[model samples]
Target: MEVLSLIAGGVTTAVQPINLMLIVLGVTVGLFIGAMPGLGSVNGVAILLPVTFLVPPTSAIIFLAAIYYGAMYGGAISSVALGIPGASTAVATTFDGRPLALQGRASLALVTAALASFVGGTVATVFFSLFAPLLAEVALSFGPPEIFALMLLAFATFVGLGGDDIPKTIFSICFGLVLATVGFDTISGEPRLVLFDIQGFLRGIGFIVLAIGVYGIGEMLWTIEQTRGDVTTTNPKMTVKGLISDSKEAVRRGWKGTWIGSVLGFFVGVLPAAGATPGSLMAYGVAKMTSRTPEEYGKGSPDGVAAPEAANNSASTGSMLPMLTLGIPGSPTTAILLGGMVMWGLTPGPRLFIDESEFVWGLIGSFYISNVAAVVINLAFIPLFVWMLRMPFTILAPLIFVLSIIGGFAASRSMHDLWLIVIFGISAFFMRKFDYPLAPAVLAIVLGPIAEPTLRQSLLLSSGDPTIFFTRPIAAPIMVIALILIFLPALKLLRRKRQVTQD
Candidate 1:
């Protein structure tokens, strides 16, 4: 009854003409931002955040949240059409999305991505609305030790599930952790790995700069090397009837992937620093693991595209729980939203629901509304986006290059970051050449800083006793789970070796 009343109130608040207009406008802007290579929800939200100051608090947050949702859908567009992910979360989507596009199934891929994203976002939003208080209570119970354990679990899961080459994945994660440690220490004000000669070293490398460099510039370089001639373009006229037919077929084919992704993405999103990238990657891994036709995954499998698209969108919604309940941002984008909330004089936490019940429920309602709007907009414009692929690679490549440079520089407005992009771009080219999975490294970079601080805090609380992690009730079980995840692969390897010796 309470949930129903809140929903009713939210519907009333959100249906206002001005509020509805803002949702439409926000989704439109997000779609544009997400379609551009190297720009994702983080950039989209950051770029538009200042504009929200001019609007009402509810309106501003609603707009930003819509952008976040719409951008997730937009990220899929480029991944399928151009074999380039618009965001890190969309990287897994490219595995099968690009293949499907190449096989003249771009329409099917795009529709599946849109529909799956809608399903994921809607389901996650429902969970967010109904179970948020219960989940928030669980989240509030976690201290520094528990938080650290959770972060470790996220890292272990990603690394273990990421790829076939365990050693390479481990190396990639270590490399990222090293990069994350270069900046000033969170505990002390001292910088540990700063190159004294360069002032920018004090700031450390920006994740956005690295992401744009590696995924955007690196992809461009790889594409240039692989292209023999003009890129092949397919223009399939998808009628409404055909689209409806294909959507039903896609849902039938991808329901399992969609459900798995939605559940995983939601839970992962609730954990601090565990964002859509890991959620999507884990979803794709699970989809592949459970697939009867696993060999078709990296080919043109529809489930591959559906799984990650669903997971990323669902995770985007899940990341909001901490921000609203505990005043802790679950992801980078939510961190920005947290800042926006503070700037708007609205404090985020349990009081947020009590004091600003209207805003809270209204934002929840907007998720359902905006998700439906995004799917409709993406479906309606599929033909135009597909037509965009007709441009020559020679033309598209340089454009992507320029956009990547601009996006990198925009990340921090530092020339040094641009230089870092060039350096990392070159490095990523080689990494790709060596077949190293970049996703694990990227995940490490995001989680390392959070994990380090939490670990230190936990230690300080326990007088430097490392056993604190294993002694706490919540943290202990979580750490045990992480251990199981980490050791499972090693156990498999050892068993294989023993079998070989016995033979």
Candidate 2:
């Protein structure tokens, strides 16, 4: 009943002409960013943050969130049409999406991705509307110990969920933790990681630079490796008949994937560091293991495309959980929003719901509107998007690279960011070849900073008693849940190995 009222109020606020227009505008821009390789939600939102200064806070946030979802839909197109994933979370989409495109079913792949995204996002958004307030209440009651435990859980979940080389993922996460230390020591006011002259480094590596490097530059390198083959030239014509066939196919193959992605995405999004990549990868892996036609995977199976796309989109909603409830960002893009929220003098977290009910609910309502708009827009634009494929990558590459540099520098107007973009571009290229996941790295960087401070505060308050983390009821249970989540994957892998050995 409480949730229904909030939803009612949210709809009312969202229905205002100005807000409605913003939703359409936000989705339109987000779609373009998602199509443009290497841009990602983090870079896209960061680039647009300055524009928000001239707009209302709620409107600005609504616009940025719309972009985030739009890009998600756009990424499917890139993966299916160009064989290049627009973001790390879409990596799994490449497994089957590109294959379908290669087989002259690109339109089917795109339509399926968009529709699945819509369903996953819509379901997750409804769940979010109902659950966020309840979760916020729980979060508001949390003390430092509980917060610390939750942060630990987030860290563990990401490390465990990431299917990449575990050691490298750990190294990247730890590197982020180190980078987090570059700023002032929260307790001592001491400059720890700064090499004595650069105050900007004292602010730590900006999220914008990291995103552009890992996503933008890294994407460029990945694209460069693929010998420019005859770009999936055949148009898999999408007609009303084709649409019906694809929708039926989506329902047939995507039901489980949708649920898996939605549920997993919700849990991961609640964690401060888990983010979308883990959700997408885990969904893909689970779908493959569960499928009756496992052999068809990675060879144009619609289920393969459906699963990851669902997970990635669902995870985008999930990523909002911690951001809204605990004031901790579950992803880099959320972190950027956190900064924007602070700048707007509006605190995020449990209190926001109580004090800014309309704003909070309006944002939630916009998710539904933007998602519907995304499907309608993409369906109409499929032919145009397909036509973009015929344009040469050689021309697109430099344009993308230049935009990345601009977006990076634009984040804070620091020239150092330009250098960071170049360096990250090189690093992202290598990481791609090495099979590393940048999402985990970025999530770690963003949340690691918040976690470390919380941990320190908890420890100090407890007089260095680590048991305080487990003694608190709410915090302890969350920690335990996280522990189970972390160990379950490993246990499953071990069981599979044992079964193989016995066979």
Candidate 3:
């Protein structure tokens, strides 16, 4: 009955005209951002944060979150049709999505991605509506120790579960932490790496700048470097046969991917730093491991394509849990939204539930409607979206480059920010050449600023007692969880390497 009542309350709050309009607006912007190369969800939301200054916090948050959800859908279109991942979370989709497009199933791939995302998003939202308060209760029991543990666990998962080499992953993460430490000694209020007072560097490298550079510029350069001869184009004519062929398989194969993705996405979403990329990749791995045709994973397996689509989409929803309850963002995109929330004078911690129950529940409720709306909107237009890929990259790339610059400048209204964009872009291109993962670096940039300060504050409050992190019952458990998460992935990596050598 309590759960039922909460649902009712959420529906009442979210069904208003203003909130509904915001959802539509966010979905539109999100789709455009997602459709474009080099403009991902994080960049999209970061660009929009300033606009929130003029709106109510409730509207602003709802709008930003909606854009993220919509972008998830848009990313699939790009991957399936254009052979370019619209977002990092959608990278897994490229393995099969692009193949399906080459086979003239582009429309079907888009439809599957859209539908899978909808299923994943809807399931997660419903779970959130019923389970948020319970999750909050669990979160409340956590202390500094537990939180630190959880973060450690989150970082470990990235290294262990990321589908690349463990040593490189570790190096990437350590590199991120080091980069994160460059701005200032948060403990002593002294600059550490500024090295002669460059004002822009004093703030450390901005996450958006880094992301646009490595992901956007680096990716663009990589694509150009690998530029092949004119490839035969696949025309995905929107046909009944295509619809039937795809829908039948989706209905048959989607259930497993949907459930697996939703669960993985939800769990990872709860972890502060893991976010949708890991969740989607993990889901794809799990789906492959459990599939009847496991060998078909990288060869355009529909299930392979379906799993990450569902996982990343569900992960996006899962990320909202911490954002609403603890004021901690589960992903970088959410971190951008966090800034918007703070700017609107709305603090995002637990008190938000009580003082802004309507807003909280309303935002949660809007997710349900918007996710469903995305399926309807994107699926109906999959043909058009897929057709967009026929446009030459030469034409598309310039526009995306422009958007990346605009989005970066829009973030702070500063030309310095724009220059920083170019710097990061070049850096990202070089990092790509070295095969370093940019996600960890970006994660560090986003979470480090918050985590480092919290660590120092907790320790100081306890008079520098090292055990203070472990002494807090809640914090200790969370820390323990983090340790387990980190170690398990490392162990798995070792076992896999041994197995490969033995084989």
lDDT of 3 by residue, 96-175 (tens): 78777656667667777877888888878877877875775664555454545545654665654455566677777776
CA shift at 435, candidate 3, in angstroms? 4.1
Model 3 TM: 0.72
Q: Regarding TM-score, does 1 or 2 come out ahead?
A: 1
Predicted candidate 2, C-alpha RMSD: 5.6
Shift in Å, residue 422, candidate 1: 2.4
How are the candidates ranked when ordered by lDDT, highest leading?
A: 1, 2, 3
TM-score of each: 0.89, 0.70, 0.72
Model 1, global lDDT: 0.82
Q: Is candidate 1 or candidate 3 better by TM-score?
A: 1
Worst 10 residues of 1 by lDDT: 228-237
Going through the candidates in order, what is the number of backbone clashes in each? Answer: 0, 1, 11
lDDT of 2: 0.74
